[model samples]
Target: MVDLKVKLGSLELQNPVMTASGTYGYGEEYEDFVDINRLGGIVVKGTTLHPRQGNDYPRMAETPMGMLNAVGLQNVGVDRFISEIYPRIKKYRTNILVNVSGSTVEEYVETAAKINALDHIPGIELNISCPNVKEGGMAFGTSCPSTIAVTAAVREVYNKHMMVKLSPNVTNIAEIALGVESAGADSVSLINTLLGMAIDVEQRRPVLSTITGGLSGAAVKPVALRMVWQVAQAVKIPVVGMGGISNAEDAIAFMLAGASAVQIGTANFIDPKVTEKVIAGIEDYLVRHNMTSVAELKGALQA
Candidate 1:
């Protein structure tokens, strides 16, 4: 039998497939469509320190092979999530993580501290990479010093595993990864979303409410792979590679490129059962190759 289990920081998974934050609602939303416990991990939707209305309508637009979204960071905030959402998802068999986002450093620290209070929540994926918000969204992620400041601050308060999400819009992704590592981040999730804009020729205006939104889908796989490879080589901490992962092949590619694991985003909307399929597919790949463990594939890429 093949051992598909993989280690992500302090968390262990039956497999390496995880549902991306924002794309996968608080784990319970897909109970009818998926077996929530089967997933290696579930990252709940992005939650801020306080409630946010997010951006206006027409926040998502489809481009060739991908889509752009500016959904802002609309959520019921941390308090509601702790009181309501946490109690419900805490029972899941697998790791249940909160994807925390904030407009400022203080908010991030506060939100993370609250999540840390929850016994069942094992970790948090910081949303310093979110490009949809107008205020303190991607700013904290792009700059090295700012990344260190925010991550270090949260590291001081949150005791559990902290995964800092990295923005792909920056010039040097490895530099950002190293910066977060220095600040006490347990692991880093990279290639959140590429900033892109769609145009409506007939209307002669931008397609999204925010004009430019985070681009995701098959189009970002190459870039995501490159960044993941660069980061895995640069930093000692494990890297969670994401962006345009549609199937087991994509997930395996990421593992081979040195990603400890991967997250499914846009593909979830196209098919709610995709996560299960990817998990099964990875197992099949291991069996076919006569590999006993999934960890063997990680960073196994040849020069």
Candidate 2:
């Protein structure tokens, strides 16, 4: 049998297929459609220290092969998540990774501290790439220094596995990846969402309220794969690759390119059971290829 189990720092994942934050809501939302336990882990929606109403109307828009979203980090805050959501989700038989966001360094630290106290949550994914907010959302993720600062700040407070989510809007993703790794990040997940825009030529205005939103879905697969490959090669820390991943083949390609594991995002919208399908597909591929372990495929690229 193919061993799909992998480790993201101290946290162990049963498989490499997981739902990307923001795209997967709280795991519970998709429990009826798919078996949540089959996933490697769940990265819940981006949570802030305080509840946020998110952006105004028209937060989502459809593009050619992907979707644009400016949800503005709409979440029920960490307090509510821990007090309410966490208790309910603890019953599920799967690792829980909290996706965290903040407008300031202090907020990130406090949120991490609060999550650190939780007994059920295993890890935290710092979403430094949310482009919807005005202050610290994508701002910290786009630059190397800011990424290091934010990651290191959270690292100091949270002792558990810390995965930094990177933005695809930067010129050099490897630089940011290295910065986070140097700052003691356990792992890194990338290509959050490409900064993109859509225009209503007839209406002479942008379709999304923010004018520009994060682009996700099949349209971003190639770009995200390249970034993941580059960052994985540059950093020693494990890379949790994501961006437009739709099927087992896409996940396999990411693994061979150097990702320790893969996260499924936009594809979930088209099919809620996408993660389960990808997991089975990966197992079939491994069996056909006569591979005993999925980890052997990591960084198996050729020139």
What digit string (tens of lDDT, one per residue) describes model 2 on residues 1-303?
889999877989999998899988999889889999889999999999999999997989999899999999899999999889998999877888999888788888999999999888889999887432445345888878778888999998899999999988899999999999999899999879888899999999999998998899999999999999999889998999998899999999999999999999889999999999999999999999999998988999885
Residue-pair clashes, model 2 = 0
Q: Once model 1 is optimally superposed onto the true structure by TM-score, how far is the C-alpha of residue 148 displaced, in angstroms?
A: 0.5
Q: List model 1 lDDT by residue over 1-303, tens digit each.
A: 888887877888788899998899888878999999989999998999899999998999988898899998889999998888788888899988899988778888999998898999889998887433444345778889888888999999999999999999899999999999999999999789898999999999999988988999999999999999999999999989899999999999999999999999999989999999999999999999989999989999997
Colliding residue pairs in candidate 2 = none
Please list the residue runs of candidate 2 whose C-alpha ends up more than 4 Å from where it truly belongs after superposition. Answer: 130-138
Cα lDDT of candidate 1 equals: 0.90
Model 1 stretches astray by more than 4 angstroms: 130-138
lDDT against the true structure, per candidate, is 0.90, 0.90
